[model samples]
Target: MFCLHFLVTSLPFNELKLGRRKYSERMYAERAKPLAQYTTEELYARFCFGRDNIKYIADLVRPKLQHKTKRSHVLSVEEQCLIVLRFYASGTFYQVVGDNMGVDKSTVTNVVKAVLVELASLVNEFVSFPKDDQMAHSINVQLVANADLIITNCVVKWPGSVHYAHILRESALYRKLRSNRPNGIILGDSAYPLLSWLMTRFPVANTPEQAGFNSAHCKTRCAIEHLNGVLKRRFACLNYLRVEPKVACNIILACIVLHNIATRRNVPLDDIYDGPEPDEMQPGQPPMFAPNEGQTGRVIRDAIVRHYFRLMT
Candidate 1:
């Protein structure tokens, strides 16, 4: 009885504050608002993206964000999305993100990679290149996505200087596209092998006619080029690519997801880039015998060239 009384009396826990300090909680990651505080514009500025985008990302990953303990909530879906976006937009260190997020560096790392994996699974949902009669124009709408936002089936994760053409050759999406549109054309640069359905540029513009074709081709494919530029410029991480290829690929896709959101909302990434840069990532002519345009491709190219020539004249 004496020992029990002594233990009870010695415990001064009741006099002390119960939980973690409020200042400490909020100094790092506890700054998350109740989603009622910021207007749409303010949210965009703070998160460096859009409200709809957060929801979209939330829908994709929220289900997967199970608690490690399953007894309490450590990080909300909205917080995870915000943390991921902050990392993408700032391109800063994980420790820095953790400080901003009020969590440990390990938490930041896990959150980013978890969100990235979820986003990567959604690549098919947001990225695509539709074919003729593929419901692109049909009411079905899933057949092909809009040309301006096409993701070209899947993204390539570089593993020590492997060529993209090899990836393209191995892609199930490319094969499916080829089979679906045997006579149709897809735009690509020298890094990709040419097929009858794939349009690449002339290596040289020795003649006026060749120059005209290349120019028209460039103009036609400029949307994709501008997209690449916009994505790189907005996220700022793609400019140098410091992360592993897997993470890098997911980051690129996530940025694209937000870019499409920004486009749909007509909300620019601030007063900065109105559109893509003038000097785009031009498509090139792949090396010979690796796979290239055939006679059918030439006919289609000739027709497009003639049409443009007529417009010029």
Candidate 2:
């Protein structure tokens, strides 16, 4: 070669066009329309909450979330809540959510974290174990819902591999039921340990009465299943989380708080499908060894079967 390096070094900087590059000036974006301009259906489709319900949520968090500074282009609490809700409803990447909301990815992340913290604080007030004891896993969330599909109690901190019975055992709700106890029983599946306050399906229906008990118990327990389906279908983010486990836990709790608000306000489920029927059992659940099963629980289950399900036979 003819000394290529010498030729390149000899070239003038101006001839090489090595002058500093000029970047395009930053252009701020705006949503096509303000949130309030959207109709009820549009709000539900994008945010998974009706306009009124969103206003309610904004109001709930305003005391804490309202911007303290008078900085330019500061986001309002309404927009902040909407950003998080959109992320929850779409379950898409943060950049995508930011694009929709006319925000940068960092802003979206910050807003979600702030609004999630505010919403999660309301969980104790919005979600609790029903004193009436009419119940019911993943993160292994242990949810207890009433017949109305309202989530009464939820334990959200457990890992995915944790056993349902173990989660229940570790939960404060479990201790409360154990000590104080409720007149009505909570229905669970074979995956959970049977307890005096919790009734699981009969392992072996030795009699028609036992078979009938299993059938009715299974049917009635469908409420919790339905509640689970409704919850996931409504908040698509809960299907799979992209955040760290600690943040995911807070997100789950916040979603439950929002769910309770929607349910209480009769916000319609706008999803194309409500998912599978509530009566259908979730498939592929491996059976667990319930060493903690107690005779007291067996006696109570037998009493219910004798009194209620025996007649069906």
- What TM-score goes with each of the models? 0.71, 0.82
**Model 2 residue 55 lDDT score:** 83
For model 1, the run of ten residues with the poorest summed lDDT:
1-10
Residues 45-149 of candidate 1 have per-residue lDDT tens digits of 666666776776677677787556653436778888888887877788887777766667777788888888887677666665554544331100111224544
List candidate 1 segments past 4 Å from native.
1-30, 34-37, 66-73, 134-147, 190-194, 206-209, 258-267, 270-295, 307-313
Q: What is candidate 1's local distance difference test score? A: 0.60
Top candidate on TM-score is: 2
Error at 85, model 1, angstroms: 1.2
lDDT of 2 by residue, 29-57 (tens): 66434466788998888888977888899
- The whole-model lDDT of each prediction reads 0.60, 0.76
